[model samples]
Target: MARMISYCMRIIEIPMLYLQKRLGISRLAWVFLLPNLLLFGLFAFLPVVLNFVYAMTGSDQILLQDRTFVGMGNYQTLTSCEDFLNPNSCKDDLFWRAVYNTFWFVLLQVGFMVGFALLTALMLNSKIRARGFFRSVFFFPVLLSPVVVALIWKWILQREGLANAALEGMGFDTINWLLDRHWAFFWSVFISVWAHMGFYTLILLAGLQAIPRDVYEAASMDAASPFRTFRRITLPLLMPTMIVVLVLSLIKSVQTFDEVYAFTGGGPGSATTLLIQYVYETGFAGTPRLFGLASAASILLAVVLVILTCLQLWASRRNVNG
Candidate 1:
């Protein structure tokens, strides 16, 4: 064991001597950086480049040699329609429908997520009874797997589940939650907000705690009402964290698939189908799996996310500078 340890030390020391004498770089820097850089290039950068290559091809074949180059044919087909506003007029109507559904999901989910998270954070941050217990209860859902959360809600929304049972006991009809178009969409948004609100609530709570207590004390001494104190001090101070929550919520809402898929399976006539689900079903799930079309859609989604991220950075910079 001592000889083995000495051998390993010699190997490392040789590299150190070579790097220090020949390259003028500390061997330690390469040790820290090379592995991560190689991993990022292989896993992250390579896939993105391959996805773009696939998007330009016009074949269902997974192999690069078998794929026929079609230039912008896949993209053109997606944008080809009598009217771009109406998805039904397009050849790939399901893709357009998924885009519309995703837009609606982001609209409602981000609002409800930020609003509910703010309320919960405020409540938990107060001197209420069992504050720690309540905080734990709220955050527990976040720690659960997304699939688990969706399945739990699916069971609750079933005909014989607790939700329907409560309705039946109240002399109200047991509505089919997952089978309805509007209700399925509503519950998708609701369940997503419920599952993720805890995370954003924790972020806002941290922001709230970072705020100096003296500011609130000053407001109280000035005879400021609770609303006035929040409006004049809390909201202004919390804007940065709120912006982060908003941007993250928008991006996540756009990429929503796993939980909603487990819950609804994009059923009731494509009511809850989002862009990611559309891409999955197109590329791998359905007959005549259109890999090219799916790749185009994936590229579009990536472009949208990139634009959102750029906007976020720009807004953050503007806020800081102003």
Candidate 2:
């Protein structure tokens, strides 16, 4: 009995020692994490907080100088101003048109981008010849700067450019790919999807590879069809990744500016104008900048993004649970 007690005491002491060691390791990990946490708070968290505070002010003038606290007045003005929020405003229908254009862009871009990315990822994951070469070719676009992508596409879509030249060669009429309002919007969506699909495909491919082969094998042995295996085994396992891709694509499409600016310059009657570009025009485009109105618009845009992000988080959680 004494030997048994001694053996039990030794086992308990071993775990206690291990616990102490783990605590020390955790402390070291946290110490290494502190600098990154501080940097994130300074850069990311501070900017968001400052933006919120600036949204309540009347001007972008230095906070210590010409700025005045406007409470919800900025938001109120935005809601009431027909020129800002209503669709009938003349000098420009920009405010509401930007909102409408952004919505359609997000919807179409997210749908096609995510769908095509999933298809590409699945194909790459299957037994294919030159899989590595195919992946690299598909992913090459992701390495290009947004400016470069926009410029290349812009040149290609011009009147005497590659696209029109090809069409002319095929005995088709040379269509104004970027000059016409409707066609400009169409090409913008197309280019944006093409530029972004590669990155999302790689992400989905990583997620696909992480799914255990045993799950598919089990489904196969059960005489399940390929469609059934994908429906029951693959999608559920890939839900988290799909949610991530959806939220990222949605946010990116909503905030898009560079490609639109480069390709259409928000022209041909402002058909491809986005919220961010509108904010830029309002704040800096004219001689007398409407800083107050621009700030108000930006606040509204931020609010929309926050709401969408919250909804996405809720949906993702529900998907995980289900």
Candidate 3:
């Protein structure tokens, strides 16, 4: 009977040891996660919280001073106030114009960028010679810094630059690419599309490559034409990637400041003035900077981006289900 009791005790002790080992493994997994969580909280979450706080108070002008709590006063000022940086002040027409211009810029840029990316991806995915070299050339633009791309295009589009010189050599009249408002906007859009299309192309190419070859072969066996196969199979499978490219391009285009600032400086009567540029000009351009107002505008921009991202996510989910 004592021997039997000893065997039962050993059985119970074995399970306890197994449970302890499992717990130890779980703790080790969590230890690996902790560092990433702490870094994300410190860098991303904390800055967002601070931005929210700064948006509610008048902090731009008095950085060192204690800011007055204004409730939703800053937001209210944004709705009706003309000056983006000053809600207490009257309306400013330039602010609204900048908003309109930014919308146009986003619409044009996203449309062209995504359309061209899809086209290039399709071309690159074909069974053509020199595919590797062509793919590399197409993706080269994305590897360059945005500032560098803008500067290179700036030189190319100048009055007596390569483009105009080529046109003149062809016996065409030299066109003022940057001086005229319409032409300046055109060049900006062109440069943005050229510089960005490569990244999206590479993304779409990856999506294309992931699609199994057997699917296309099966479609062909069923007497499906190339166009029909693409319309029915390729497009549906690519929807997720398309949605990603669209959302990213839209957000970047809407928040466009660096390239525009470096190229146009929001010049020629505010022709290329984007929303972010307006915020910068309002807060930092003049003698007395309006930090509170700038913060409000920044919050508004963030809200817009969040809304668009949510919409894209919903659309992508629907596509996947359908």
Per lDDT, the best of the predicted structures is 1
- Backbone clash numbers for all candidates listed: 0, 0, 3
Badly placed stretches (over 4 Å) of model 1 are 1-7, 26-32, 314-322
In the range 1-322, model 2's lDDT, one tens digit per residue, is 9999999999988866676587785565665677999999999988777767766777657452578888877666556544554566533456778888999999999999999999999999999999999999889988887788889998898999999999999999998888798899988898899898999999999999999999998988999999999999899999888988999889888999988888788878888999899889987885466566677788789888998798788867876786
Q: Give the per-residue lDDT of model 3 (tens digit) for 1-322.
A: 9999999999987865676587785565665677998999999999788778777887545653578777777766666755555423545555666777788899999999999999999999999899999999988887888789889988988888999999999999998888899988988888889888998999899989988999999998999998999999999888888887888788778888888888988878888888898789877885567666777878888889999889778877875776
Q: Could you give me the TM-score of model 1 versus the true structure?
A: 0.92
lDDT of 1: 0.91
- Ranking of models by TM-score: 1, 3, 2
lDDT agreement with native, every candidate: 0.91, 0.84, 0.83
Kindly list the per-residue Cα lDDT of model 1 for residues 135-233, writing each as its tens digit.
999999899898998999999998788999999999999999888899999999999999999999999999899889999999999999999999999
Positional deviation of residue 49's Cα in model 2 after best superposition, in angstroms: 5.2
lDDT score for residue 112 of model 1: 94
Q: Looking at candidate 1, what is the lDDT of residue 142?
A: 91
Worst 10 residues of 3 by lDDT: 84-93
Candidate 2 has an lDDT of 0.84
User: On TM-score, who's better, 1 or 3?
Assistant: 1
